[model samples]
Each structure stands twice: as structure tokens, then as C-alpha cells.
Target: MEQLATFGAGCFWGVEALFAEQQGVTSTTVGYMGGHTPRVTYNDICQGDTGHAEVVQICFNDSVITYSQLLQLFWQNHNPTTPNQQGPDFGTQYRSVVFYHDQSQQQQAVEMRQTLNNMGLFKAPVITIIEAANQYHLAEDYHQQYLLKRGKASCSL
Candidate 1:
């Protein structure tokens, strides 16, 4: 069956590229989520006042790749200890967050984050937040597949 997973872990460009290359991911859309603003935009998000995070909504086949595996991918890709920042990007929109689509996704995200913390993988505690999926505002057309179109695998930052 097909499932949906939404994540905000730094720049959505790299995040979308990473998932788009995954075996089971069917599609990835860069967007804004977890915000109070309605009809948000890239410009609005860039201002860092929208309370939204730059996110990628992923569609994948569960039979090919489990949600847990996707969560692992998310954890390995970005630093969760830093709040409101990822590499060169710094703002509320760059915060690490997992927007769960349902209870199953919520449980898995919480457990994986806990497991990572217990393992003491990072010097600082993981601060990635897990929240229910909120209204998603699609980014401008140019933002979608930004890296892939440029023949890049991931962000240089």
C-alpha cells in the first residue's frame, strides 16, 4: 500500500532529493508545514515569521520500504540537536520536525527519536519535534526538484 510521510529536516531541496532517490518513494514535494499562516509562500517562510518549516511531503510504497526505514534515513541525513538551524541555513523554517500523518507514523517517530537519544549518538540531546501533520503550502515551481534538475545529489552545505 502507498503511504504518506512528511518531514522537515533542514532545506527541503536536499531532503526531497534524498527521498526521491529512495527505492520506494514515488514522489516528493517541497513545501511549508507546521505553521499558523495560511497560503504561505517561499518569501513568507524566508522571513521566518510564518512559524512554518521547510518540509518535503513524500509518497512511498510501504511494501518496498517501511516507514521505519524512512525515519532512519531522515535521522541520518540531518542534525537534530541544533534548533532552528541546519548547516548554513538558520531560521525557524530550517528546524527539524517530523509531521506524522497518523498515529502509526507518530508512534514510530517518537520511538526512533527516543532510541537515538538513548544511544547517545550526539553530544547534545536530540531536539527534533514530532507533531501531527498540518496544512501544507506547496512551494514555487522552481523549488521543486531544485537539486535533481541541477544534476546534484545533495546540498553542498
Candidate 2:
């Protein structure tokens, strides 16, 4: 079966690129999520006042890649310990978050985060938020597969 997973970890450009290269990730859409705006744009998110985070919504085949494995990638790819920030990006839009689509996903997200915390994986506490999936407004066309289109492997900060 296919499943949906949404995450906000730094720039969506790199995040989308990373997942796009993953084995089971069938598709990815860079977007804005966990916000109140009805029709948010990349500009609005950049302002950092929309309560939205730059996120990538991924569709994956569970048979090939477990949600737990995806969670591990999420934890490993970004610094979840920093609140409302990641690398050179600093704002709520860059916050680390996991948007669970179902009760099972919710449980998994919570447990994974807790496990990382218990392990003291970082010098500081992990502040990544585990929240219910919210409205995901797809970003402009130019934003999708940005790295790939530009022939760049990743976002440079």
C-alpha cells in the first residue's frame, strides 16, 4: 500500500530532493503546511508570519520502505534539536515537524521522537514537533524538484 508522509525540515528544496532519491518514495511535492492561511504562497511563507513551515509531502510504498525508516531519514537529515530553525534558515517556516496522517503514524512519530530523545542523540533536546497533518498548499511549479531542475544535488544552506 502507498502512504503519505509530510515533513518540515529546513529547506524543502533539499528535503524533497533527498526523498525523491529514496527507494520507496513514489512522489514528492514541496509546499507549505501547518498554517492558517487559505492560499499561502512561497512569498507568504518567506515572510515567516503565516504559521506555516516549508514542507515536502511524500508519497511512498510501504512495502518497499517502512514509515519508521522514513522517520529515521528525517531525524538524520536535519538537526531536530534547533527550534524554529535549521542551518542558515531561521524562522518558523524552517522548523522541524512531522505531520502524521493517521493514528498509527501519530504513534510512530511520537515514539520515534521519544526514542531519539531517550538516546540523547543530540547535545540539546530534540524540539521537533509531531503534529496532525494539516492543509498542504502546493508550492509554485518552479519550486518543485528545484534542485533537480537546476542540476544541483542539494541546497547549499
Candidate 3:
């Protein structure tokens, strides 16, 4: 079955690159979500006034790759302890977030976060927001698969 999972783990470019390499991910789109404004552009997100976080909406085959697995990948790829930042990127747009597509996903994300917190993997508490998936405004064409287009494996630039 096909399922949707959206995550904000700092730069959408890196997030998109990470998940796109996964086995069951059919497609990945970089976008803005959880914002008050509508039809927000990349520039609007850069300004950090739109209340939007750069997110990557992934379409995957659940039968092949479970949502739980994806959640694990999310945790490993970015620093969830930071409130409004990831790596060198600092802003509301770079905050960690998990936009659950349904009740099942919400439960899984919450559980995983709790488990990770108990495990003491990080010095700080995990601050990854778990919320219902909402309005997703697709980023400009140039932003999609940015790293892939540039033949880069990660977001170094």
C-alpha cells in the first residue's frame, strides 16, 4: 500500500536526499508546511516570517518499508534536540517536525520519540514536533532533488 509521510529535518534538500535513497520511497517532494500563509514561496520561507518549515513529503510503499523504519531514519539524519535549528541552519524553517498522515503514524512517531529520549542518545531532549499533516506548498522547481541534480550526496553547499 502507498502511504504518505512528511518530515521537517532542517534543509529540505538534505531531507529529500536522505529519504529518496531509501528502498521503498516512490517519490519525495520538498515543500513548506505548518505555516499560516498560503502559496508560500521559497523566499518567504527564507525570511522566516511565514511560520513555515521546510518539509519533505514522501510517498512510500508501506508494505516494503514501514513508517516506523522511516521514523528511525528521520531521527538518525538530523538533530532533533534543537528547537529552531539543525546543523548550521538556524530558524523556524529548520526546526524538526514530523507531520503524521494518520493516527497510526502519530502514535508511532510519539512512541519512537519517547523511546529515543529514554535511551539517552542525545544530551538534550528531543524536540521534534509531532503534528497532523497540513497544508503543503510545493517548493519551486529548482529546489526539488537539488542535491541529486548537482551530483552531491549531502548538503555541503
Candidate 4:
């Protein structure tokens, strides 16, 4: 079966690219989530007042890759210790978050976070938020598959 997993780990560009190349990932859409505003734009998120995090919504085949594996990728790709920031981008839009689609997903996310924390994987504590998915507004077409369009393998970050 196909499942959904939404993650905000730094910029969506590289994040989306990473997952899109994965074995199980069927599709990926870059978007905004966990925000109050309706139909938020890239400019609005950049303004830093929309309460939205730039996110990538991934669709994957559960038989090929488990949600736990996706969580591991999310944790490994970016520093979850820093709040409201990633790499050179400093803002709420770049915050690390996991938007769970079901109770099972929620539980898995929480447990995985705790396990990583207990393992002391990071010098600072992991601060990635695990919450119910909010409205996901797709980013502008120009932002979708941006790295691919530019013939780049990853974001400069």
C-alpha cells in the first residue's frame, strides 16, 4: 500500500530530492505546512510570519520502505537540534517537523525521536516537532523539483 509522510527538514529542495531518489518513494511534493495562513506563498513563508514550515510531502510504498526508515532519513539529513533554522537559512519556515497522517504514524514518530534522543546521536537535543498534518499548500511550480530543473544534485546548503 502507498502511504504518506510529510517532513520539514531544512529546505524542501534537497529534502525532496533525497526522498525522491529513495527506493520506496513513489512521489514527492514540496509545500508549506503547520501554518495558520490559507494558500501561503513562497514569499509569505520567507516573510516568517505565516507560522508555516517549508515541507516535502512524500508518497511511498510501505512494502518497499517502512515509515521508520523514512524517519531515519529525516533525522540524518538535517540537524534537528536547532529550532526554526537549518544550515544557512534561519527562520521558522526551515524548522524541522514531522506531520503524521495517523495515530500509528504519530506513535512511530514519537518513539523514533525518543530512541534517537536516548542514543545521544546529536550533541544538542533533537527538537524536531511531530504533529498532526495540517493543510499542505503546494509550492509554486518553480520551486518544485527545483534542483532537478537546475541540473543540480542538491541544494547548496
Candidate 5:
């Protein structure tokens, strides 16, 4: 099945860039997830009270990239040990999280987390949560394809 994976690993820009570069990632989007609100503005989420996380929704071809492979890439790209932060970005919105789409993913996330923890890969324990996806609010137009279009103005992180 063609599957989707949603993750919040700090700033969506860096997270989006990493997944977009992956071979099997057919499509990717910057968005907010794991929030109670149906649709929330980016500004609101930034304030840290929206209960939403800054996330990237990845659409990948399962034929080419297994979810486990994607998860591996995810672990390599971001710091899951830090709670509510990635690099300079901090707060609950930037919290490390994984929004599993189904039961298999839930199990995979748990297993992967255990493996990573057992390996002693990081100082802080992996705080990424695997929650059932609720709603995904696509980022504004200016935020879409941000790394591609704004390469000159901003660093790729």
C-alpha cells in the first residue's frame, strides 16, 4: 500500500527538506498535527498553546521505501532525544513526534524506539510520540516548498 507518515521533528523546514530528498518520498508537506483544533494558524501554534505540533506529512511509495527505512532516515536526520526542541527551535510545537496512520505503524514506532533506546544512541531518551493522526492543516503558501524557493534567504538547517 502507498502509505503516508507524519512526523514533527522541530522546524518543518529542515524536516521537510530531509524527507523530500529521500528517493521514495513521492510528496511532502509542512503542516500542523496532533492538535485539538481543526484548523489553526501557524502563528497560533507558535505561541505554544494550540496543542498542535509543527509537523511534516510525507507521502512515500512503500514499494521503494519501507516504513522502517523511512523511520531510520528520520532517526538519523533529527534529534529525538531532546524534548520539545530541535536545534534552535524549542517549545511544545517543536516537540519530537510521530503520527502513525495505522496499527502496523504504531507497532513499528514502538519497536524502533526501543531499539534506538537500547542502542544508547543519545543522551536524552527518545521523546518522539507515536500518536494516531487526527487532523493535518497544510501550511500557508509561503511556507510550502520553503527550502527550494527560499534557499538564498535562509539556511537549509
Candidate 6:
């Protein structure tokens, strides 16, 4: 069966583009999560008051790509130590996070992060959040796959 994983690295554009090309990912959706409001706009997320992070939800076939594989990709794609920033994007809304749907995912995220830390893979400590799935508000159509069709989309992770 297909399962879901949610992550917030930075601008959803590049993140979505990167993951959409990964093997075993059934689909990807850009959205906002870890916010108080049920429906938050992109502008509001940019403002940071919404407490929402621009996130991507990946639907992948577990048989093809394990959750651990996705975690590795997440670690490789963005800077997790900077705290609320990736590449040029700087704000709380761009914080690095991994939203897990269950205990297995939670354990995997935690273990993978710990392994990275032990391996000194990151120059600084990782700040990626491993939390329960929060309300995920889908982004507008234009923001869905901004980088695939548009070449000059946000390059921030």
C-alpha cells in the first residue's frame, strides 16, 4: 500500500521538484502544516504569524521506497541546522521539519536523525522536527509544482 510523508525544508517549489523526480514517490503535494489556522494563505505563511511551514506531502509506495530512504533524501536536500531557513529563504515558515503519521515513522525519523548526528554528517546540530501529523492545508494550484514548469521558481530548499 502507498503511504504518506510530510516535510518542510523551505520553499515548497524546489522541494517538490526534487522529490517529484525521486523513485517510488507516487505523488507530491505542496501545502502548509503545523499551523494554528485551518486555512492559511501563502502570504500568511510568508508572514510567519500563521506558524505554518511551507511543506510537501509525498505519497510513495513503501515497497519501492522505504521511509528511511525518504528521510535520507530530506537530510541531503536541505540544511537542517540553520533553523527556520534554507538557502535564501529565511523565516519561521521555512523551518525544517518531518511530520510523521505514526510511531514507526516517528521512530524512523528520530533514529535517522540520531544516526546523522552520530556520524557528524551535519556541521551543526540538526533542527528537523519529528512531530505528529498536523493539519495540512493544500496550496493553490499555481504553487503545486512551481519549479517543474517554471524554471525560475524559488531555489531555496
| Candidate 1 C-alpha lDDT tens digits along 1-157 | 9999999999999999989999999999999999997779899989989899999999999999999999999999999999999999999999999999999999999999999999999889999999999898899999999998999988885
RMSD each, Å: 0.7, 0.7, 0.8, 0.7, 1.7, 1.7
TM-score of each: 0.98, 0.98, 0.98, 0.98, 0.94, 0.94
- Residue-by-residue lDDT tens digits, candidate 5, 51-155: 999888999999999999988888888899888888888899988898999999999999999999998998878878889998899999888778878664334
Whole-model lDDT per candidate: 0.94, 0.93, 0.94, 0.94, 0.87, 0.89
For candidate 3, lDDT tens digit of each residue in 1-157?
A: 9999999999999899999999999999999999999779988889989989999999999989999999999999899999998888999999999999899999999999999999999999998999999899999999999999999999774
Poorest stretch of ten by lDDT in candidate 3: 37-46
Which residue pairs does candidate 4 place in steric collision?
Answer: none
Alpha carbon lDDT at 57, candidate 2: 95
lDDT of candidate model 6 versus the reference: 0.89
Model 4 segments beyond 4 Å from truth?
none
Q: Write the per-residue lDDT of candidate 6 for residues 1-157, one digit (tens) a residue.
A: 7999999998888889888888899999999999888789898887779889999999999999999999999999899888888887899899999999999999999999988888898889887888899888999899988877677544632
Global Cα lDDT for candidate 4? 0.94
- Which 10 successive residues of model 6 have the least lDDT summed? 148-157
Alpha carbon deviation, residue 63, candidate 5 (Å): 0.9
Model 5 misplaced regions, further than 4 Å: 152-157
Please estimate how well model 3 matches the true structure, expressed as its whole-model Cα lDDT: 0.94
**Over 4 Å off, model 6:** 151-157
Model 2 Cα shift for residue 140 (angstroms): 0.5
Off by over 4 Å in 1: none
Candidate 1 overall Cα lDDT vs. reference? Answer: 0.94
Candidate 4, position 132, lDDT = 99
lDDT of 2 by residue, 1-157 (tens): 9999999998999999999999999999999999988899999988988999999999999999999999999999999999988898899999999999999999999998899899997898889999999888999999999999999999875
